[model samples]
Target: MFRLLIDADSFPLGKGPMVMLILFLISTIFIFARSEEQGQKLEFWIFANTHFEEYQTRVPIFEAENPGVNVQLINFGGTMHDKLLAAMLSNFGAPDLVEVEITSIGRFLKGAIDEVGFVDLRPRLESEGWMEKLVVSRFTPWSYRGRIYGIPHDLHPVVLLYRDDLFKAAGVEMTEVETWDDFIAAGKKATRDLDGDGTVDQHAIVLDRRTESDYFSLLLQQGGGFFDEEGNVIIDSELAIETLEFFVSLFNEHKIATPVYGTWHGDPSNFAAMQDGKILSILAPDWYVGILKSQVPQMAGKWKAISMPAWKPGDRRTTTRGGTMIGITTQCKNPDRAWELLKFTYFDRGGLVNRYETTRIIPPLKSAWDAPIFKEPDLYLGGQPLGELFIELAPDLPPRYQNPYWSEGADLLNDAIFAAVTEKQTSREALTELAAKVRALIAKDQGRWRDL
Candidate 1:
């Protein structure tokens, strides 16, 4: 045992005895560490390989504030979708907190899984006033029939990334290309045989044939979707047919766009196309900036972003694409503690600022827009303030919904897009077949939503 002794050399020197002070500090630190070690451990499963470093940096701050709680940030690499589905189906091994991407969350939002799978957060949202703090549109993707299951982590507003050097060389001005027709004309002019190879060596745009960004981004920008407000299948609508025709015409008719080999990441063809200067522009979201920086650093400072060219003069210029949301599962034992961690990680002012500053992720919280981090100029985009552009485009985005059959629908649509663009079938014919197949699926899966 340690004995407490009082030193009288200078009546404790007005600072207490040195040994006692040192022991007190040590005991306080020990108690704090022990409390944190014995805290309620909440498991958080995340699938973002790119943003993991930034997340690791913020986890400790949350743990420090909530001394009785510890969060385990587990990264499941690229197979999170399959793993999550398996867990939800088997009703076991589900994490307390799970980050679901926009492309895959539709499965969790519909069907039997959605009925008893996750916690409905609307009550907590109303009590905490989080609805006003966050962008309402960001939550739309994670919302099911009359329920919100998750909180969005960021707003992924789409933008047109163009090479200024290529644009200047092609004699195309962004301001002059306001509509899709103008963009098509510019594309035709931009495609050229720069090296005198007797073949058009450079095209105006490159698109991912697999992911069908043209269908999702452009269709949404034109206020069209695969489904309507009442969850009806409408992929064969006039707007969708026209959008499909226009997207295909860029490659088949104008010969201004190149079809890349794969979707989004690890596609050597896309990487080579960008490096060889084979395209003038690519329509992508703000998150693609990070991909460009990490995957093709050589092209830094040569690219700039602009609002998406409108379908018509007064049409919406931009629409959102990809994002991730954190949902609390019904498997969560300590929901109150999990909510505390979620609030600190996402809604906390300091965490939001740090995330934006470090990762360039546009937070969904409206209050975060006022931070000085949003005003910082990006060096990769020729000193363009990309945040301001996203902020401007985020609010006007048209509402979008994903049905339970979106995964199947996306697959069928990708096939339809491939068929139409490859000249195997007409756009209308392919989409009509697609709509038929999707309607059959919706009917077979559940008899009620087959009215399309």
Candidate 2:
């Protein structure tokens, strides 16, 4: 049998070695004890590197202000939602907080409102008066059945990004363009055979034929969407048919728009087309500003933003596109602490301003709009106050409802649009078939989730 002595003078081993071992054990224990006492380990899962970086800068401030709190920021990239959805269903391995993109939010909103995996934020928003402080319509994508489950991260107000140089050279007056009709008239003049190659070399606008989001934006701009505020399918409504017809006409009849070699946002060819003066204008959301600056820096001072051409003389001039929301999960053990972190990251003015400065994304917090950064002129847009221009359209930004079937609905709508544009089916026929498919999906989803 071996015996250990705590008395240094009577120790069997050397006093120095015993003392060192004791110190190491004590330090190890102390470290673990301190970690336990640190309180509330909040795991925040984000998919975007930019968002992860932005929150990393703010986490230390939050930890310092609220002592003994720790935040673990994880960037899971594109597979985040799938992993999150799996965790939610299994009731295991879920993060304390998560950032859900607009397209992915609907998947988290299945079943009854109470059955949602994310905590319902409506009561807090109302009690704290945050509902009024933020852009009201910005909340629509994060809410279900009047219950908001997340805080909006951006306004995403859509605007027309036009080549001012091209418009001026083509003798088009932008101010006189109030409607889509006016826009098409201007496109006729702007679309020209600059190289005299017999075929028109320059198109007035860029609309991605492969992506449904472009058509969705036009639908939203005209006060139409896949689902109405009441959660009913409206993809085949008269307004939607009209919007789809106009979308098809842009490429088929007018021939003023062309699809880029790849996606409007990612492809190098799109930037080359812009540089070569082949594409004149694009419908850009606030976040697209960062993309343009990073991709086509040479187009500085040549581009200018304007309100989107309305469908009619007095219709809404802007629509919304991409958005993100941050929410606390129902699985969080320390929900109050999680909410504090969420509020600090999203509701606090300094955090919002820092996000805008870093990402060039317009915050939904209306109070933060008055920040000097928002008022500054963007050199890339010919010294135009780009932030102010987006803000101007923010109020009129239309609401985009959340439906559990939005993902499937969007794919079906894409197919419908493709059929119409390819002349295989009329716009009405395409949309009516799309509407039937969506209704069937809704019925199937309802049957699966009886509480919905």
Candidate 3:
């Protein structure tokens, strides 16, 4: 009984119109059904392009394995943490998962642990035996009040990257340089005035007077840090004072290290210095290998890695530096699914292998250390099985703790280092002042959080 009208004309409904309507109905149903099949869409945010690319390759596999789930990766670069923080504060438009750099993680943990913007993954980590599988110390930077909030991405163990050719030519036997004393003695021999000028041209090491990383590395190597295991401010600890004095003495007293030109990583000037043989060695973490390979590819086979010299024999020769963690936001509606994706990306063996191959970054997963990819010789480092060396040093890496004011504390420590190194203040005086300032900041933070 249906009819159709056009302008002033009217006609009985035809089979063609009926067929068209039927097809439209079928197409609408099919569209919605396909949409339903697409299911949960997870928004993941990352700051690093390398990390983003790694996830892009794995997302398709995850989608195929998990029906009805899709992942959208967004790389916000340097603004990622700022945007994530704003979303967390405003409770709007947040990604289900995000990568938090170690330095930025402290800001998110300022509040009570239960109220943090990221989900507390401690239960899942313990229930699934992830705690045992991954290196425990790596979790420290991503945890607060004993509750872990993120999965560690890398081990980042520090090692000595030295010019093997230079050392051999200088007759400095690296094998005998097991302690800092021996290293200092060898460094004196390696330091030379290559151009016959009164000023020294080649130095044993590169120390950045402006940056905090090298200082932190040496401090952590000696079991000293800004805070104790109990989270108390210990910037002025006797151990820390000694470490600062020693760090300063490297350039001021020993005169064996050259001031870093720009930065030890990623800077063209530093790469040029290395290429020109102006510096003999650098304290590098696992991640630095990629930088060296990519930036100074011509240095292949000329450089080598060795365990860092200990303060004394029998001490830990490795220290941890920079790191990253992947975490699910508290705003995630389906934390279970997000957790699955997180585990797949960071914890799964296949995913870890893909990540290692892509980044050359040693995974915090202890079991993944034995992968064949890790055993393969690196031609860049004189065919050394660099991953194997990192694995040997992994268990001994010192733990680095996190506090809400960590960034501020680090800045203050840098200022203290500059003061002492420039003779504006003695190391003890500078560190003592720094400890007081850090304590005051911690107290202020406690009061603000208590109010919240």
Candidate 4:
């Protein structure tokens, strides 16, 4: 403390001051070198308009545990897709990690971009037996050319969310509904005009006419999707045509269901229908639970979630719908650390528990289901253990072929559905027409598309 500064003019030896200065510089460099080695840095970017805020709460735990790692979270929200596309096109500015929506993921999986854009996670994933741990079909949507590119954020297993009160009023017991035929009969019984108006006020179920969402849900459940295992279009197959016909019958022949033209589940009229007991049930995925809770809060305790009714008495009881996949981009500067962050967010049991507890987005990891939170009864579903039901249905999910042309293909299918239901075209007629249109579209870009 006497004198911290060294005076070169007053130094005893000629080289003493120079040696001391060098020593000080070396010490400073050593400290900085050690500091940098200890603090590994990672940069992450997510979609701007998405609800992944829980990551903000949970990432601190990851950083704290890693000690020398710093993960910088950048949220692009609304323009994330455009930015990500630009970054990929230029081969710059892409994030180490990204959250890609299921519908939009097909775009990223096509052509040269897929080869250079996203890392193949299979090597690391297989080492840990990651596929065996989660439902195997959960990998289907994120897979392209037999390579797994992303980890599933949630299973989004489809469930039939129904009004138990309405089921009771219709004299239909949940256990009694074993097959789709039984479901249709119950719907017929449930639908009636309470006020004796010419128009029936109540319907057994609701579907979207402008969208193939409900049709897609059921079609996937029936093991018929837009593409087959070999990447060939199979949407016009016998099973696919049959599934479409069944959906059409619900409205025209059975008269037990009604169609909404736009965003059916999110529509105000649909919410009012749910509130007024006009629509007793909806064919939706697990994420739709939060939508119901927020959009139709008064519906609490009156609803229940059950595995979707099977097409046959003992077929697979459920299928997957909407979900997101978190992937590691090939442009990652620190892929090892990036994988660590991704594994923690998606595959780690504790992280999954925290994710479900905070955001209520169910995890794809099966071990996470053992947590007490998953076991607790949801009061929103009349104390039914909906989590347990979702877990039970996870294993049986059919593999979905999400091809590059899926976006355009889905539109064609929706148009086909519209024709089948509204225009009263036979399922075969609608699908045959759809197949021709899809075939032509695919022929234009033969490499990116598969033949029907």
Candidate 5:
């Protein structure tokens, strides 16, 4: 046992203490700086649409496949614009990749996108010659601004979804109603009350006119356009009038649709009402199939789907309805890797297969058409190969509206269309009013919306 030397106020040892303190501080800062620079999130930031939860389950699959790669999702509401804007401005809020709806791609491409944060996928496409893999027709929306900005997954056609049981109970079959005229007649039959009760518990059709994006499909199918080549509102033309009239006929003339179907005329919610069995049929994209299966599993095997009716005795089959695109946001730190995931999720065969297997949502890509998932006749969809129908229908689709103000004008137009369908406003009054308001909005935007 040696005697300990006590230093109460030791002047000599104090220098040692100072040196240790400085060294400790330096070490602490070095460690912290290094940890931050490494940027460990144990995840890759990705944005997605409503089906994210189902996709998230595959994270383990992604990690297993990519080794160290891990992905995490930041779900913004169904509203991509609002969420994306919040993220872009924060710069810190930006996700590595953004999943944008195809219908809104033009808008995002034109306005919502952060000018700095995008990786032009053209180089990748050309270098890899992935363009050969793509059916050029399927890449329509991604072609805006003369450059490829996003990778497309599937041609999500807006098809008709109907309750087979309801259609059968009404003594009608989808095959018999190939044209719009026949559809109305069948709808009238399906509109009846099963119990012979006074009140009609089920509506024949649910037309959510409030969904402006959806309505655009019919408009474009009918040769109606929201804007011209230079970008100006074109909803006031005779075609626009005819489109509105057709939209309203479900309520005004056919008597097949009830208040539930026509009430939201402009603001459609076929997914909600149709899935809930409040209505017999709805018009939606293949993306809706997954929703139908997931939300109303009980209705599986009972629901059926068909392509949109021919516009002019086969003037091309149908127009593009709605879909999502995977683009690298400007805020992304790992665009190359993020784009790889993007290509996999939408354009890659494996990604398409996974989406179909887990969610049954058809991709817009061409090759996936032959994938076993698409070929499988869905028991829920009455053994129908819904995937084939979408594939055959995709090439004929016109460009889905992709302009920034298109959605804005559409929302206003739908409000009016909905009102007219429900008899809140006459058809003429509604369309005219909508056109005027949209024009005003365009004028206010002072960009592509100026008068023709």
Candidate 6:
């Protein structure tokens, strides 16, 4: 066995050169896997692909506090939804703890978890008095058939993320975009090049909202309402049609986001493209900035955020985007241990780790917002108190109209958006097709669409 003897002065003088040479040789192949599982096998499931490091710092703390419990974390990168669906069909998909995206929670609740493998978290929340503190409105997407099925973790509301330095260089007034019309105008002005370069140095904006007139749902503040109360697809409405035409106008008329840039070929994250400096402004969510800061640490203080653009002069300036739900599996052998992790992840330790320390997740607890840590100006946001602005917009969020059809509906919408943005089909024609497809999907699936 080899060990270290701490010698204050002579140790460094004797071992410094040797340590440096050893570090150089070992650095290339250094392998540090997560702590190994202990005696009891406890599986913890989450949809963490990029933020694995955040979980690293929490593991030792949790394991030390609660002995005799082993932890296993399952990460599903791009195939999370598809894999879960397959596992559900076989009755073998139950994880001790699972994280579901709120946007697609309706599908999991209706077909996979509600009457099947997942247990209701409401009882635990009520017994612990966490229900009152959690953001109720943030979790409406997970509610199906009038039952609370999931708990909120972080919410991604579409907002304005802009380059302030560019705005200043262009001599453009930086303020809240009054309406979509004004936003489109701002995109045109912001999409300019300086330094007399023949090629454009920066673009005006990038709108990555890909879905079947789905931007219509966000624009209309509806969750792509493919089925009505009577369960019939209503894509033929004038409001829906207007939504389609407006997306096309973004390319044909305004020329803000390029057809190629608006095209959905890869991830829509503002974090990915912001570093390349392709676009100057984007309509993004609150947590998006956090993702940027963590992944591309270089672009730390160059960005700022604003509320989503309004449809008209005085319309509401908010729309929902991303959020997460943590649930306990019915197959869990150690729910108490799982609950500890869930509670600690969402409610304990001053909410910094969940909101800040653990990466870019926004704490779902309302009280966390008012805390001194969250109230201060952040260096990443150019010393602006972005948390205050985010909380101010929280109450203004419209209740999400989520249903089982949301996931497939998102797929259909993605197709339509791609076709229109890439000029494979006109916006009107693509949305018309999307509306027709969604009607058929609803008719075949459960829900009131059967009668309609």
lDDT of each: 0.81, 0.88, 0.87, 0.81, 0.67, 0.65
Query: Model 6: how large is the Cα RMSD against the reference?
Result: 11.8
The residue pairs that clash in candidate 1, if any, are none
lDDT, candidate 5, 295-331, per-residue tens = 6677778788777776556565566666656677766
Off by over 4 Å in 6: 1-41, 49-52, 59-68, 79-83, 102-107, 110-114, 126-129, 193-201, 209-217, 220-236, 259-277, 334-337, 352-354, 422-428, 445-452
The regions of model 2 sitting more than 4 angstroms off are 1-39, 447-451
Candidate No. with top lDDT: 2
10 residues in a row with least lDDT, candidate 2:
32-41
Give one digit per residue, the lDDT tens place, for model 3 in 1-452: 66443422232476667667768999999987865443298889999988999999988999899987889899999999999989999987788899999989988987665678988999999888889998998888998887888899898998898988898788997767898888899999999997787988789999877767888888888888887767899889899999989989998999898878785455799899889999899998988888888888899998888899999899999999899999998888789999999988997787888887777889888888779998899899989988889889999988888888788888888899889899999999999999999888778777876763
Which regions of candidate 4 deviate over 4 angstroms? 1-39, 48-51, 113-116, 447-452
Return the TM-score for each candidate structure: 0.87, 0.91, 0.90, 0.87, 0.78, 0.76
RMSD of 2: 5.0
The true-versus-predicted C-alpha distance at residue 66 of model 1, in Å, is: 1.4
Model 3 regions more than 4 Å off: 1-39, 447-452
Q: lDDT, candidate 5, residue 348?
A: 59
Instruction: Give model 4's clash tally.
Output: 4
For model 2, how many clashes?
0
Model 6: per-residue Cα lDDT over 38-114, one tens digit each = 22556666676644455555666777777766666778765676676666667774677777776556666555434
What is candidate 6's TM-score against the reference? 0.76
Give the alpha carbon lDDT tens digit for every residue of 249-305 in model 2.
Answer: 999999998876576555899888889888889999988888888877888899998
lDDT for residue 102 in candidate 5, whole number 0-100: 60
Which candidate do you rate higher for TM-score, 2 or 4? 2
Best by TM-score: 2
Model 4 has an lDDT value of 0.81
